[model samples]
Target: MGASKVIHAIYTDDDVLMSAVKKIKAEKHHIEEVFTPFPVHGLDKAMGLAPTRLAITAFIYGTIGLIVSIVMMNFIMIEDWPQDIGGKPSFSFIENMPAFVPIMFELTIFFAAHLMVITFYLRSRIWPFKDAENPDPRTTDDHFLMEIPIYNNNQLELENLLKETGAVEINIVEKDEAH
Candidate 1:
């Protein structure tokens, strides 16, 4: 396959970028990615991305944490080492459940938070100490970058469309060619 050409359309305003994305999608053009300094409200919807499932994952992780906390506390405090919980010798896990509430709550939050971060990192292909993959460094500041891949050798048409959509600067960059 021939090396694809990537068009980087730089827009200063997110409103303009969002409109461009809608227009481009209407033309049935596939947008590769969009980079902005901060999150742009409704950009994901504009790009027609599916809703994120991370929240569901977080809830599942929290449930696991709650179960773990209950099991671990039962083993440690009630079964293995029966202790005087709340100045009462509560030998039952249910009876001692009140004292374990705080631990369970904290563990639920901890597991959900930590696991969610790891999930997001993995999903984004981000790892610790990794170089940034942004095509332009300016996108990290005040600029927004929209990357579109050219197919069918329709470069001029794409360029014209981008120019009409209020792109401040448009650059045609070649993807890394493999020999």
Candidate 2:
């Protein structure tokens, strides 16, 4: 494949970045990616990306954690070694469930939070010791970057549009096609 040309538009403020994104989308140009120092609200909607399913995964993880906690507590308190504590004999899981509520809640949150993070990392292809993908490092500090790939000899048009959309700095770079 031929090397593709990409335009990197830098913005100082998120508001300007947001407006630029909106204008770019209005012009029907496909945005490759957007990098920001912090999360920008409604950027995803403006980019026309689909809604994330992380909440559903978190709920599933929490349910699995709850089940594990219940089973562990039941085995330890009722089946493994039944002991009389607080003047009550540990026999039935239902009867002893109240004392296990705290553990259950904690385990549920732990699983949901940890597993969600792992899921996000895996889904985003982020790993320890991985190379950074942002073309400009300033996007991590105090700038926002919008990447738009040029196709069919539209570099001049895109550059003009980006300049009109309040891009502080615009750069055209040749990016090797990733296999």
For model 1, how does the per-residue alpha-carbon lDDT over 4-123 read when each residue is reduced to its tens digit?
788999999999999999999999999988999999999999999999999999999999999999999999988898977458995798987888999999999999999999999999
The TM-score measured for candidate 1 stands at 0.94
Per-model TM-score, in order, reads 0.94, 0.95
Runs in model 1 deviating more than 4 A are: 1-3, 85-87, 177-179
Worst 10 residues of 1 by lDDT: 170-179
Q: Residue 158 of model 1: what lDDT? A: 93
RMSD in Å for model 2:
1.5
Per-residue CA lDDT of model 2 for 62-113, tens digit only, reads 9999999999999989999999997999979999888999999999999999
